[model samples]
Target chain A: MIILDRRQIEDLIYLPAAATAIRDAFCSTSRGEVNLPPVGHITFPQVSGDCHIKYGHMQGKPDFVIKIATGFPQNAETEGGTGNGMSLVLSATTGAVQAILHDEMVMTDMRTGLAGSIATQALARSDSRTVLIVGTGPQAMRQIESHAAVMGDHLNFEVWGRSASKAAQLADKLGGRFAVRSVSDLETAVRSADVIVTATGSTKPLFQSDWVSAGTHITAVGADAPGKQELDVNLVARADLRVVDLAAQCLDHGEMSHAAVQGLIAGQDVLELGQVLLQAATGRKSPGHITIADLTGIAAQDIAIADVVLKAYRAKGGRDV
Target chain B: MIILDRRQIEDLIYLPAAATAIRDAFCSTSRGEVNLPPVGHITFPQVSGDCHIKYGHMQGKPDFVIKIATGFPQNAETEGGTGNGMSLVLSATTGAVQAILHDEMVMTDMRTGLAGSIATQALARSDSRTVLIVGTGPQAMRQIESHAAVMGDHLNFEVWGRSASKAAQLADKLGGRFAVRSVSDLETAVRSADVIVTATGSTKPLFQSDWVSAGTHITAVGADAPGKQELDVNLVARADLRVVDLAAQCLDHGEMSHAAVQGLIAGQDVLELGQVLLQAATGRKSPGHITIADLTGIAAQDIAIADVVLKAYRAKGGRDV
Candidate 1:
């Protein structure tokens, strides 16, 4: 099997292609063309760390993906730990090891960011600009790059964070391609933005429901696990259109779970991203629609992205070692 | 990460050490010291192939292991497939990929064979001499090698299979160190042997219950998944000592499951290998006792064996590639 390091993986990513693949993967998952077993999770409470194992195979696909992503917050303090992860691509026909991508969670962030961009591009108004991103992290950077890659450089961007210096730093790093700057007032950013993406690890709601205006689209990316919430339950309930990557997953965690728990929404009330992509379910109806896409992540995305990477490696004549 | 191929893994294995590690892993599992998540599986019905993902971490250990094993019987007919598998060892402290062992199911077979030997050595009578192994497969070879590795080479071994030539070939291949010969009459072989090991993918009992004699110990090694059985349900229910690797897994799809479905056994009736190893449960009670160990395999064993391989590599001054 060929082993690609994180740098090699980063060099191979084409956000536009990845976005397309991820969109198709979302559809495949909703259409029941993939086998996604229950995720395996191991928690280390002593160090506040946890590891997640997600694996799946899409029907008719050449390869299956087994992904392992881990988080150790305490390690960052002394070990300079940036969460590590890798995905293995194996032949679906013979179950032979095909390739190993030691991307160190880069693929995860890329696929997630692509999901955010895909949802935003499909739901946000065509004339939308002034996209606001909450939090200054790797995902925040990915959100900007993927959105720019898929949505174009015509849209203006604003970043908001608790620390002004960090937010400005992020803008400076990503400022070459698009118009981006740091903003201090989150409320104003929420009210005035055409689209909002919340990517923080906060357990409580990041913003109030009343701050969001009509005709706005929000993609909540941070609340992918239990006890994580990025939007007010009322905001989720009040949205005119609700799109999710997967209903079962979104209901178990993520931003929609809070609304679901409060009896504001049921499973049937939500439309999957795949369904929307397939036109099996309706997306935003009018400019007045307040749309939300809750992405809790899924294994299908990993399989899709891995396939994309493997294709790139093959094109480059990468040899098995 | 360091990548070790099948040959490297084979050279690194010390069967006695592996048996010890597997035995300790069993004990750790029963003591609730390991975080073993439910296994993930995907099936490819068109190819009659299936892949299983088992992973876990033992508390206080330096690393965790995620194992992927796949079986593609149809591929063997056309693609010269011998099955494929790999294990990833990651640091538990930071969850970083430490080493990758692309053993191609070599590690799997070794661990399984070692489990059989460990159980046999612990339960079989000291004076036992004649050993009978049913079926001629890789597992059958592993059972013979591992049994000799742990139980010494003084005992006589008999091979039984439907095809006399295949059984004779197996016996000839393994006849260098010990007395081994292919026997024609399975009933005589089973009745005369002091110990019996069944290692086949048979879905039905290989031998009748009445074929087994007093003072015999049988290690049923092939009924790992559902729709597979090597011992009659009556034989399983009739054993004086019922030992299992893990009660839940064994009862789910192994030889024990058949007896369980017939309401012939319950969870409490079986003694886990770890419990017996820890002296928390009984093994063979008398010289005339009939004992059986049903192993469905567990992630803890994979983790244990992976650790053993990784240590061997490190000892050789293997550098990160």
Candidate 2:
């Protein structure tokens, strides 16, 4: 068995490969040939721990991936503690325990970021240049990195955080690659940017419907837990194209929850990310259309990244038996 | 994080103190306060891999354990290959990824054996001496070790396996202390044994109804997966005391599946192992009564053992940050 620490996994597996694999898996899953099961998870409000276990085979792939991830209240940095650990188990067709990945938190961040990038790649217009990133944590940084990687070469980036100092620090870290600037005004950033990414841990909507402009792409990466909202229901209702990782999950817990509660977007109106990836339908048909991609994360992404990590370990002469 | 190899975990962590902790955790879980979620597992009948992802917390425990175990068909001969590879992620109440255990297979074996030992201690009479072990696999060996350790003093042991060499090998290895003998006839071993254990991977019953003697205590540990049976339905029907790890799981998948299907025993007749352990009711009231413990391994056991392993690692100077 191969055991990989965070650093080892990061160094060996790149985000581009992982993202591509995830995109492929998502498309395959939509085709109904992939054996991905409905996720089984439990939220223990009393103890403050929630876990999701997901497993399945990617169509035409030789191996299967099982991901077990848990988030505990005690591990929140804001709660004066480190966050809970996450891990993935990758096994092959021959039943060998190929790799045990120890960098679950990083994996989660990267895969989640890639989901946003994939959505933007499909939904955002090619000429879209200015991007607004709300939140200045690790997840926000990863979103910036992934968007830059997928969009490529020419785009202006703006950052906003609850703390001005943190926003300034994030702007400095961007290193003038895309006219990085700190926006003291949230509305100004939301109105001007061609694309917006929200990575906050807010329990209420941070963006209002009036702040959003026409012809902008929005990626909502936070609001994973119940009662957590980052975008107003009106904003969600106004979007011409709304895509989700899993429609059922999003309606239950994603930004779509608010829209669903308001009866703005019915169950049938929400399109799955897989459908968009497979090109079975259009994502952004017009240049002036408002598109929103609500990502609550998916297990297929975990499995895809795990497969990449396992392959990298094998290439580096990792032990087999 | 602390990552222990199989041998290191075995040598440094296994102890009576750990066993006691696990037992206590198991007992507390039966009180209905802890929420142990159902495990997510996949079976590859097309190939031969069996993968399981289990997560839960013991009652009053500070950490949650999530274990991923996979059995490889190709490496079944290695020390731990027949069983799946197990990894434990310890998420403490402080919300830190406190530790990562890499040798969960060994810990699982120890904990599973302890479950049987704990059941026998609570259910079997003090005079029960002769032991019969069916299916001479690693699990059978551990069952023998645990039973001998818990039962103490003089005990006669007989082993039966499909392969005569395997049975003889186990007998030779454990012969000195327990007066171990290899028996060609399974019926003879079952009839003579006061305490019988069935740990085979067979899909059909290994022990017949006529084979069991009165007052015998049987621990069936191998019928964990669906359609895996180790004792005849009639034998279960005649059991005076029927104790199970989890009645729902046993009725759906374990040795009790056949009995329940044949209408031999009602679902309500199966007693939870914790209920029996707490002595809410008698296990074996009369000297001539027959008893059976159907152990379909539970997620709570994984949580219990993970607690013990993490504690042992910390006590031995292991660190996680």
Candidate 3:
């Protein structure tokens, strides 16, 4: 069997193609065409782990996808860091060992980035030119990449990080394409940007309802684990349109969890990203509407990305790709 | 991140010492001192998967063991056979990455053989010399190797397989010290042998009640998966002592599942092998008593064997040893 190490996987696999496939996979899964199993887990002491498998068609693509993922506490004692995750892929039409990937953190970032980009593509105003991103980690960088990929030359970017140096470094990395700022000036960045992305690991909310301007789109990707919040409950409640990757996971562990706990949004109030992507439901109704998309990540994305990785590997003569 | 291919893993690992160490680990885990979590899974027409994290002390060993295992069925499609099964092991005290093993089937065979040898040592009469093995696959060979390792000079072997060639081949290979015989006559093999090992992949019972004579000690390892049976219900009902690897798992999927359903053995009738090993329960009572050990593979065995493999790997400087 062909084995791809971390470096090869990161360099050879195209994230843009993976993102597109994952978006389509999510849409197809929501239309009752996918075989997605309920996640199960055993948790105790300092460790918790979960597994899920999903199989589905992607629009005109008739292939099936399946993935398994596990999460350990970042502080847990393991040779690899606790958040390390891996996925194995197989072809649905012909059973073949497609690919094995060590993209635990990368998978999380890319999928969340795709979710944000998809939401922005559908919901953000076409004329939207300025973007504000909160957080300066790899995930924040991916959000910028995804936004630039999808929005093309229509947007300028501003970034705010807890550490000013990190934010400036990211801004410099972006070159003249965007302007990056520090958390001290986050208010100015948020007020002027037409779209905002929050990608922090904060356990408390970073954005207040009063900080947001009218007709702005917000994508929150950081509050994935339980008790990890990145947006104010009031901000979520006040959004004219709010979408989530998976309604159940979002309500239980994403930005919507706190809002649901406070009765700001009932279970049925949340709309799925797939529903919006397929045009079965409306996204941004008006240019003046406040939109929020909460991305908690999902197995469908991993399965989709795995499919792409496998195909890419096969196309490259099934080795080192 | 040492990745060993199938051949490398097979060539470098020593099973005899690993088997012994695994047996000790299981004994230590049985005394209510393990730190493992319960295994969980979701199975449906669309998807099938399980995730588990387990840790516990083997009944008689000082070191505790832990493992995380997860798999998705769709993975098999990509691999061109069965989906991949992967597990990570950690040292309980130091919490270091001891080893990572792939292919659960191989791990299962090794650990089950170790368990069988451990039970044979504690339950079989010291004078018991002849072994009747019921299958001729890798598991059967492993059982023979483990039994020979522990029992040493006190063992002679007779093997029966559906394929006469395989049985004869095994007999020829092992005949030098053990007076090996290939028996098409399964009845005579069972009746005359002191220790009977049933390792076939039969859905129906392979042995009848009349075939088992008094004082025969049967180690049935084939009835691990659901719907698999190796011994008639009557034989199960009539055995004087029925020992099981895990009473709960046995009741659900092991040989005891059929017996329990047929009302041949109550759930409480069988004793756990761990309990017997720790003297919390009894095993063979008299030389003339009929005894049976139902060997259903368990996660405990995985944890135990992983601990052994990790120790050996480290002691040998982490190379294939």
Candidate 4:
């Protein structure tokens, strides 16, 4: 079996291909061709750490993947500081392990980043050029980079965060090749951008309903846990189309849950991102359509990315290529 | 992280220590100190294989474990053959992975054998002597060896199988150090033995209720999946004390389920092996007490054995030693 450490995963993971694989995974999922069991959540209350075991396999796929990921909020005060993970890909036919990817959270970021980009590509207007990203964390940065990779180089970016200096620093990093601006006003960034991606870890709403534009596509990447909200319930109610990375999970714990709890939208009304990708369901109704894609981060994306990474590794003749 | 291949697992795994760890795990489980999620069963009909993801952690323990096990029945006809597995032990405090034990299927066999041993020691009468084991499989052999290891060297053995030659061969391998005899008459073997351990993969009952001797402690190690049975319904009802490795699981797919379905017994009435170990529940009531331990197997046993194996590997100072 092959092992890919963090550096190897970083070296070989191609964002464009990852986005395409993720698109297929989501599409397969919507078509009921994916077998993803309910995630196993083990909570350590004493240390406030949680480990989630997610497994998934697509029909006719050569491999199935199981990922163990842990998040410790207390790690932020210490040197370790947060989440890390490892994933295994097993041969479907013989039930033998194929590879052990010691991704160390890189694949997760890559998959989520690609999910955002893919969603934007399918749901956002073709002529859309302005982008606004919320937060300045690692996830937010990856979303910006991955979106750039999938959507081409002509788009301008507006970065917003709680910390002004960090937001400016993020804008400066992407300033070399693109139009980058750090915005202090959240409402202005939300209203003006053609594509809005929210990646902040928040318990309260950050954006309102009226601030969003008519043709803007929003990818809500945060609010993965219960009681986490990125956009107000009114914003969700105002969305012309609501899509989810994974419908079951997103409806349970993602931003959709907030809207569902408030009776703003029923879960059945929400579309799956895969459905939009395959055109089995509508994505953007018109140039003035407003779409919301709630990102809960499913196991299908993880396995799909693992397949892409391992395939690349094999194509290059094994490790360290 | 320490990775122990088949050879390393064979070298490092000590059954007596594993039985004790398994004992602790069960005791903790009965006391509700163990956090074990429902086993994730992902079936692949295309390959005729299935992968089960199981996770468990005992409160106040330093480690938690997740095991991914797959079974492909068609592999037996081909090269790969039946079962393969991998497990991870994570730090309970930080949720950081501590060791990766690439134990093929040795730990599984060892753990199951140890479970039989532990259950026998705890539930069987102290003066137990004659032993009758059905089937000449690896599990049946291990049960004989492990039983002798725990009970005493004074015990005699009777081996029975569908083929008398296979039974005689098994007896020949064990005859050197102990009183081992191959018996063709199943009734004579069942009636004369003080302990009966059935480990066959039989779809029908292997022994009737009247054939069983009084005070005989039976460990039904076979019948792991649905529709598999090694003993008749009457034999199950005849057991004075019915103990399960895990009550919830056994009552669903194990021998207890058979009894429960036939209106012979209620699931809640089945005793837990851990309850017997902790002395919280009655084990053997008298010298003539007939007992049955339904060993469907569980993640607790897997994690417990993982703990013991990892500790042994770390104690021997690392990778090779």
Docking class of 4: medium
Q: Which candidate wins on DockQ?
A: 1
**TM-score ranking, best first:** 1, 4, 2, 3
TM-score of each: 0.96, 0.89, 0.77, 0.92
Q: How well is candidate 1 docked (DockQ)?
A: 0.73
Say which candidate scores most in lDDT: 1
lDDT on C-alpha atoms for all candidate structures:
0.88, 0.78, 0.69, 0.83
lDDT of 2 by residue, B243-299 (tens): 998888899999898999988899988888887667666677888988899997887
Candidate 1 stretches greater than 4 Å from native: A77-81, B77-81
TM-score of 1: 0.96
| Per-residue lDDT of model 2, residues A60-167, tens digit only | 666776665566654545421223345545555655556667675677777888888889888987789998999987778888888887778687788999998989
Over B171-288, each residue of candidate 4 has an lDDT whose tens digit, in order, gives 9988897788999999988888888888876778898889887788998888677767887888788788899988888888788888899999897678999889999998999878
Q: Is the docking of candidate 3 incorrect, acceptable, medium or high quality?
A: incorrect
Q: Candidate 4 versus the native: TM-score?
A: 0.92
Of all native A–B interface contacts, model 3 reproduces a fraction of 0.05
Second chain only: TM-score per model?
0.96, 0.94, 0.81, 0.91
Candidate 4 runs further than 4 Å off: A76-81, A172-181, A225-227, A319-321, B77-81, B162-182, B200-204, B223-228, B319-321
lDDT of 4: 0.83
Count clashing residue pairs in model 1.
0
Put down candidate 4 lDDT per residue, A233-273, tens digits, no spaces.
89888889999988788888899998888898997879998
